[model samples]
Target: MALGSKKLRVYVWFTLPALLLYIGFFFYPALMGLNYSLTNWDGMARTYRYIGLSNYAAIFKDERFLHALGFTFKYTLIVVVAKLAIALGLALLLTSRMRFRSFFRSIYFFPAVLSLITIGLIFNEIFFTILPVIGEALGIEPLSRNILGNKDTALYGILIANIWHGVAVPMVIFMAGLSSVPKDLHEAATIDGAGKRQRFFSITLPFLIPMLNVNLVLLIKGGLTVFDSIVAMTDGGPGTSTESIGFLIYRHGMLENKFGYATAESIFVFAMIAIISYVQMKWLNKQEVGQQ
Candidate 1:
């Protein structure tokens, strides 16, 4: 009993600092934000009154906010699908017996390590300057214009940059998952006359489902809260066509000083992310169980 008590004390002593920091930095701020969301705080005045749900109610009626929300959903769907497909393909290619496999893996993952803002800025120049020059030279009218400046195609520019910056982690994850798949199973499948596609669907894909879930959750969360790339690239410009929920919150809270309204929007975004992630995780977990 004494030994157990001593161990418990040691554990508590080790964990207490981190626990307090978590509560102070994360939990406390989150609760305060929620409290402020119910108020009419403007973030400048010293005194603010609790308005109770007016800010949330205003969200539905705000056309700009609704448009931003819609754009965010569209962006999330496009990025998640494209990122996963590209990452999985790259992972498979890198994992196969090929020349300079390690070199290719590093090349693919290099963009992920680069700063997203920096990449966005670089791509901004590419989209606005280099592409236009090339397009004019090639006599292609579609590419002749500044892509980031065009409302019709602005979101796609951000999507491409995001995919370039985001695919590395998922690729690495898939590589790890692929590495874990038993070699004997694959060899046996080949011996049994299973072709590449057949072996992939029957053997490889089943093993990768967990990693797929992990990547999907990560990509979805990233897509939902995307901000830095858009800020650096377009600043949600081209008539607010690329404004994500995170950017909307930023504009309200930081730019407009409507902290209460921003917080309300944040709460909605949080709820959305939580619900979507839960559904995906639950569905994926069921698939995992079925596979087992």
Candidate 2:
């Protein structure tokens, strides 16, 4: 027992370096962000005036900030829903014993491996060109008036590209979840005369709930952080109609030199994410309990 305890102590000592590195890098920076948000600080200023809650107050009063917040939440919600529904359907389809299934899965997952900037550039042409090369050869127009160039349609166009790009993540996760489900359960359901839809709802979907919960949270977080695609595609353009809170905060810190204000905005984004994640986790847990 004495030798075992000594080895355990040595193992704990070995893990300290990793823990210290994580605390120094990630958590320390995050705490500093919270601290800076309470001060009125420019980037290289000699003094940062402590402003208490003024920075937070300004966020509520700024019309542009409010608009950006609203738009960001709306964009996040829309893309998340679209991705979940589409990815779930694709997961179900591809998991079936269908033809050339590996090829189909690769095609679905391919976009996920592409860089965000590359995907944005490729889709930029798709949404802007009156006719793609193949479309022109087939005498079919691919699109009209650059979708990303218009104030009215620019935001919606971004959402479309995001959903298209994000589906593979959930699909892969769901495919894994589906595979882990017991085959005997599905076989028994079929033997008991459960139809396809019934079997899916009763057995498959119930078991998939945990993975769905995880992927849903990831999709929402990814949608909130969307920037590269929006920047490359619309440049927040036509009139800031597609401007997101992430970009708004970015411009504040880098362009306007309002570090404190940007920090406040970032804090707000973090809170929104935390609250949304908490609510979703609670709901998912409830659903899991009810299913069991």
What does each candidate score in C-alpha RMSD?
1.2, 2.3
| Local accuracy of candidate 2 as per-residue lDDT tens digits, 42-146 | 866988999998999999999998888788889988988889899999998998989999999999999899877888888888876733455666766534356
Candidate lDDT scores, in order, read 0.92, 0.86
List of clashing residue pairs for candidate 2: none
Per-candidate clashes come to 0, 0
Model 1 whole-model lDDT (C-alpha atoms): 0.92
Clashing pairs in 1: none
Q: What is the lDDT of residue 264 in candidate 1?
A: 94
